[model samples]
Target: MARPTLLFCGLLSFLLSCGERKHIAIWEYPEISPSPEVQDYFGTTVIDSYHNLTDLEDSLVQNWFKTQDSLAETYFLNNDLTTQFKNRFHELEGRTSGEVRMIRTDEKGNYYYLRYDEDKDTDVLFYREKGGNLETELFDPSSYTNEKQNISYLEPSYDGTKIAIGFDPQEEFTSTIAIYDVINKKFLKDKITHINPDFGEIEWLPDNSGVIYLYFPFVEKSDPKYKKHSFSVVYYLGDNPEKRTPIFGWDKTLEIASDYYPKVKIGSSLDSYIVGYAAKSGIFYDSFIAKITDVKLGKPNWKPFFKASDKIYYNQGEIREQYFIYRRATPNGNELCQVEIGNPNFNNPLILATGSRENPITQFEVTKDHIYFVREKFGVEISIFKIDNQVNITQLSPPFVPGYASFFGESVAHNNIGIGMDGWTSNYIRYCINDEGDFTNESILDSPQFQEFKDLVSKQIMIYSHDGVAVPLSLVYKKDMKLESNNEVFIYVYGAYGESMSPFFSPTYLDWVKQGGILAFPHVRGGGEKGEEWHTQGMKELKYNSWKDLIACTEALIYKGYTRKGLISLYTNSAGGITAGMAVNERPELYTSFIAEVPRMHPFGLESATTASSTSYIEYGTIKDSLECLGLIQMDPYINLKQNKYYPATLLMPSNSDDRIPLWDSGKYIAKLQKYNLAETPIIMDIDYKSGHENSSNYDAAMDVNARIFSFAKSNMRY
Candidate 1:
């Protein structure tokens, strides 16, 4: 652990009690505060170390983590099925497989693709045949390891004969793609080495002209000073390297010119399929499809489609010749549409189905008659809507009752396409769609990890908010676990950028909840709860609404006799970190403590800060835009610290390799508060070295965090 240094001296702000609704014994807070000073960090001239500490803290934290990261790395790298977490969550024990993500297919009758291990360096990929013939293989990524050994992404070609493989040794080295001969067991010499590899898409052109080549233009910062900027070409390689071309064309009015959520847009005609790109305009990345109407390879020439944070999933199987059903976004901007094909000349895209305005329209598979897409709601509800002239809709899941994370099924693919539905409380029954469009074999994909959790005698509950708003929260304390009003509690909230915190079972969390701790959540604004408006409402000027709603929920927790002050904690990262931090500062009375994990908040007084593309620009008006928004005035955690006298003991953390908020935001606040804090509060600066934004992925790092959090709160928030 690193030590804290004092820079200034001032009186401590008077300590106050927990929120008015709850009570707890109190301790003294330091009355001293720091004076401002200018310093240079990472070559950037930060105006004042007191307010701008991103650079300084980043450097120090990075160094600290580098020295101590090995142990944490090994702890999490241990992929033991019986791997134990400190706070065992009883509800999650049998319910989750600990398999982070997986995918499935209909060709093999009932097959699925799953990640073999949690360790990236030694991970495996398993292909379980529909009838239960599981084949396992080591998928090494294609880095510069002297051999073609890597699996950055896996996209089985449309014909299933070739798999497009994308892998990179490191970011400094551009990712490349290769053709893995599925049937012949050979690597193709005509490998398409692109700037970045994609696992979601592949082209099976009519003539086997090889996969379409795609590329993009990228920019890299010279130093942290923000003084010099340079650009680089992210090249793409296809069939004939000699004939291959790099994509470079981009229009500012039409393109976002960013790599945040970059994807190659491909348009298929009767003859071939080519590539295109999208740029970020905040959360929305506008899409452009490749117009191979001409021979030259580059960005699409046709007008762009709407924007999306993720790819609109389409079926890998073809729809006759020269065309296939593609997932299209709602032109009216409400729900996503299952169009036949955007290209008007080929086949007119019929509105086959539409998802709720809240969740983007997902593309699963296209049959002669019905189209399958999950109708999303408080919980995921699978609904098979008809295509073309049929125009019929059917619901798949039972009506949601509350206290359930989501009714969404295990997304074997990005769109959760062609998979059976589950309400989180039950085992998943994975069925297949036969050639005649008949469904059969409702086999259970729920592993032992999931079955273990179902033994508990608890059911899901839907808790309504003050406005008759049904906030879906998953709750499972021990059956013997006391529902005592004063028990310890923690809730995680991250509601922005179309991000949905899935209700999958986590062992460590279950252990904690089972041990008499109440683990809960609030499906609040600034997320995909209701729709785009829900997220927009909690972002920017209205951003404070998220924090306020969280605070309201916390109050409701105690009022409903769920938990008491000095016994409850809040967890959030990225954008939710801002919400958690602000709530802690504004209403210190409600929280026992809070964790600001890689907080994505404006460093307030910090200088030269970069933010996430989605909510950051909206919440914190950028210097480039120059247009002032009310959001910039509010939602500043560092700025509001001076007025926060009754603040909770905080855990400030950031990853040095984190590309988003960096490390200074947490540092600046701590450096300034050390002087003025009157409480016996310790500013635990949790740092990770080699880790990127995935601060919690490492088991040891997560354990260290849990230990630190336990110690911090046990010592300071004790009643």
Candidate 2:
């Protein structure tokens, strides 16, 4: 064993406060004074007391936050049960199927890629010489002075002389971009700060003189017009950062064209055309394009790129010369459409490729010579193909693993197409496809040790919901494990944003499975698993479908004798937090415990959200609308929570610095739960001071969070 084994037998109750097990006392919650605030949505009056918690900058709220975090740290971290969980996690952390993500090569053929290194405790950037097999450590984010800071992105310049890296403190949404000299292996003094780490991206100029990126202002509260908006600027290396020229934003005319502000992105081609996306509603958007030369000259005659249509919620594409290859949302699936650059309207658009709801184009990449695309069938099997300039489609041959791949265009040799894959039950592989359609994978890193997982069984099952909708479920457990009502089970869900949960090997999850716990992933509606219609059915007014689907799945599991109510726990984060939180509140008896990390407790309470922008309103709908308010009232976990309820033992993980979802959402949620719950069920709030929704950047800190969560689930999930 890599770690000392602690006695875990009979200590489960001590770790998690299981029902009827009074071994652990319920600690008193921190005293929070209610500041009632009311709002009138048409005729309905909504009252809020813990609303003040949303004011993160308020002196009283800050003090309360500090006190609550301090109390949580002492209550959750400094304990024997946590130590045991950490040791157990360390035991399983080594059992991994390593992955390589975003493999790229510079003009000099120097290869660069990010590798998930368990031993290093953080993802490290590795560099390989043109033809060398030996990989050199280019950047290890874990070596930062502030242990919580981690590298978020890496963008190598055209000439490969400089690699622009963006890093941020863990869980937070702010990033700082620093230029690194690839030859010198050192970072430059120039740094670009106030970047919206999640959505912001950097692109180097063709000449390699500078880069174009976006940044938000450093203010306590953003201007309403500029809320969650980033201004694009061109930063020249070794030049004064403050002197960077702003190329985007300050456009009052463009704001009228779309409800949301547009962000700038440099196209993949050498044409140096700047693309802008202004999302009007949902996933559908209107885009604009302008040349780099015009923007540099301070004129920037922006022209309409993709015009939005009411029927299409998603219209995006890559600009290839005078033609634009677009993917538009269709009734059955996303279909590819093309239009000439100087077209007056999309009245005469040509359909290039068509797909159904089951076999949709998940992603597409445009290279100089070909357009590569990945088509997913039923969210399980994936197929890749390429289309040449003459519209000749060619499907690559066998050894096609079911996983995700990223294409990095053609290499310097132009004879091969650079590709990287994240496979199921396998390590990430980076290779190239030659003109002969043969894959030549270069060994850049060693495969992860997964010998222990050979005995585990992975299966896909379908459970019928209350409405008879067959929701897809993925289950993984030891082959010898028996299906029983007393078995501990964890259900993970993310029922929003059309995001599909792919089956990938995770040491943390494998550890749980190794310990006889069953892991389940329910591909419920609101995810892209079944396409846009599936997502639409579980969002906005129909949002209750997400939670209802979760409940139905849970009940189905219990009915099937997989696990009893008191033996099952649920885990959800980000938007899924809203789904899981609401589901548990609606059916508290169905779960033993719950973990909601960086949750959006109150979608209607946008005032409390960190990045409450116009874009979010499109997803959750505006609170000012009576119809939306009614739906929000029915689905918002914070609003639906009642006093004197015997809620399941719940752990709320919130970071103090998360700018995407905001920590205040969790603060106010913990306040309400503590004030309402009268049962001994622990409503523990584990607050990370430096982390946010994404959790800690430091591997140790992140592991601690996982240990606490896994331990709580293991302990509380006992009958």
Best prediction by TM-score: 2
lDDT of each: 0.47, 0.70
lDDT of residue 460 for candidate 1: 31
> Model 2, range 1-719, lDDT digits (tens) per residue?
01112222221233333332223654566677888788777777777768777777788787666666555555454455668878767666544424566567775567788877777656788888777888888887777556535566777876788887777544335667888887888888898876654555677776777887766664244444344445667777788877777676645667633225456765543555777766443676667788878876667878876656623334246666677676766658676667776673466677766678877777776666776767776565567787777887787763656655666645222334666675445445667666655787666655566677778877777888878888887787888988788777888999887777766757777778877888888888888777788888888888888988899889988988888878888998888987898898889989888997887787777632434654566666666677876777666788778889888888887766665566677777788888898767767776666665555344566677788788777666556
lDDT of candidate 1 over 1-719, digit per residue (tens):
22232322222222223322222323222222344655443343433435423334455444433323332232222312113332332234324433424453432233324342434433344444445645645244423366634355565543345556655323222356676666665566755543433212444342334544334233132233221111112223243544444332333444444433334433222334333344332444444444454423344354554335433322222332334445543422233343333553222344545556544443344443455544445433334433433556553433232222221221212222244444434444444543233445344344444443453433334455445545555455655655567677777777666454445444555544544567676667676555555566676666776777777778777777777887877778776876777777688778766676677655344323443223245344543432223354356666555543656666666665454555566655655554445555444445654444534243343554554444334334445
Residue 247, candidate 1: Cα error in Å is 3.7
Candidate 1 lDDT score at position 558: 77
Number of clashes recorded per candidate:
53, 2
Residue 95 lDDT in candidate 1: 40
